[model samples]
Target: MKAAVLFEAKQPLSIEEVTIAKPAAHEVLIRTVAVGVCRSDLHFVDGAYPHAMPTIPGHEAAGVVEAVGEEVRCVKVGDHVVTCLSAYCGQCEYCVTGRMSLCIDAAVRRPKGAPPRLMLGDVPVAQMLNLSAYAELMLVHEHACVAIDRDMPLDRAALLGCAVTTGAGAVFNTTDVTPGETVCVVGCGGIGLAAVNAAKIAGAGRIIALDPVPEKRAMAEKLGATHSFDSAAETVADEVVALTRGGVHHAIEAVGRPQSAATAVKVLRRGGTATILGMMPLGEKVGLSAMDLLAGKRLQGGLMGSNRFPVDIPRLVDFYLRGLLDLDTIIADRLPLDRINEAFDELRRGETTRSVVTFG
Candidate 1:
């Protein structure tokens, strides 16, 4: 199997002939179909986030189950599925309490001393976030993926894995915006666009989309934003407050920058919550001002959009099929796996909404 292998930080991933092991107990092997090139993966590639070397980094993906371990029952050999990074151990407190996204149990991976799931010759290749979909195939815990309706196109279904799940899930699960509420989404990339679309579905009275890029702002309006703004403008915060006549009911930070997070907090109305969906720099801190805290403004992180993948993903698929969610508009380009680096380059340029790497 050929995979893009990242041997070190701040370096390009090289295509290599990697070997994939068969499924272990509770694991499933999937034939990669389509995977989204996300900024999160770029974070690791650029060393914004640290990870073990010689790892395969792609995560947002959908594929067909080619095989399953003896104990795997959630999916069969022929099922179509979407892979999620938030693999959970059902017995963990987080999982039992309905917070499956927070589960960090090691049971999902092979025990120490066990043979590696992937290898390049004699060296082990670390898997990124449980599902390394950049490769031709992926071996992951059954809990990391959920079978979806076959009718859902695998390419679009790939978006549901991360960008869609994180963005839409933040609206539906994290903030729970009520009808007539105002929402301001920072950044108009894949995640931000999905939030805009979900805000519309949630019946937000006013949906504000912010991005430095004019094209992205226009895309946001096409999806659902009632207003669009240049995020790089000096008075963007003041503009948002002025347009809303005070501040928005919910503000989402999807750019993963300190400045963007601050803008999200700045645009929130009293008692409003700011959900940070982007993965910021590891040591960076985000906080509300003392005055804002007194005003009941709150800030929180929405990891993987507080997802419960088994339930949320299938419903998301239905939403797309019903034309309620616009995955089609979010996708900007589709490239073969070998051209994965070009997709990342576009992301660095902040010129595309979402780029997908498709396998044969």
Candidate 2:
């Protein structure tokens, strides 16, 4: 199997012939179909977030189950599935309490002595986020995936694996964006645009989108933003407050930057919550005034949109199939896996919404 292997930080991923091991008792082997090039992966590529070297970095993906382990019952051969980074150990306290996304039990992974899931010749390659979908195949815990309808396009389904799930889940799960409430989504990348679309579906009275890119702002409007602002032209928080006549009921920081996270807090109404969906660098702090806390403004982080994939993913797929979810607009283009490096370059330049890498 060929995979894009990252040898070190701040370097291009080398396309190499990697070896994938067979499924273990609770694992599944998938024939990679389509994988989205996400900003989260770029974080590791640019060394913004620390990660082990010689790993495969693509995560947002959908594929067909080629085989399943003896104990895997969630999916079978020929099933179409979307992979998630948050692989839960069903017995963990978090998983039992319905917060499966927070489950960090190492039990979901193979024991130390077990054979590596992926290998580069004699060396083991660390799998990124449990599902290294950049390769021709992926071997992941059954808990990390959920089967979707076969009718759904793999390219579009790939987005649901991350961007859509995270952005939309932040609206529908992390925060309560009730009908007639105002929402302001900071950053208009793939995740930000998905939040705009989700806010509309949640019946937000006013959906304000903030981004420096004109093209993204326009895309946000097309996806359902009631108002759009360029973060570079003026103060985004002040503009959002002015437009809403106060502030929004919910604000989402979709870009993983300290500035964007601060702006997400600045645009929140009294008693409103700001959900930080971006993966910020470790040890970076997001500061808030005591006065803001006194007014009941809340700031918190959201992992994978606080998802319960087994339930949420299928419903999301249905939404897409019914024409409610705008997946077609989210996918800017599709390229083969060998062109993975170029896709990341496009993401860094903010030139495309999402570039998916396909196996075929």
Tell me the whole-model lDDT of each prediction, alpha carbons only.
Answer: 0.95, 0.91
Q: Which runs in model 2 stand beyond 4 Å of their true positions?
A: none
State the weakest 10-residue window (summed lDDT) of model 1: 337-346
Q: Can you give the lDDT of residue 77 in candidate 2?
A: 96
Residue 264, candidate 1: Cα error in Å is 0.5
Q: Give a tens-digit lDDT track for model 2, residues 1-360.
A: 899999999999899999999888999999999999999999999998888879999999999999999989899999999999988998989999999999999988989999999999999999889998899999999999999999999989999999998999999999968999999998888888888998988899999998898888999999999999987665778988988888999999998889889898888888889999988888889966997899899998889999999999999999889888898997898999889899999999976889899887
Off by over 4 Å in 1: none
lDDT of 1: 0.95
Residue 259 error for model 1, in Å?
Answer: 0.3
- TM-scores for the candidates: 0.99, 0.98
Q: When superposed on Cα atoms, how far off is each prediction in RMSD?
A: 0.7, 1.0
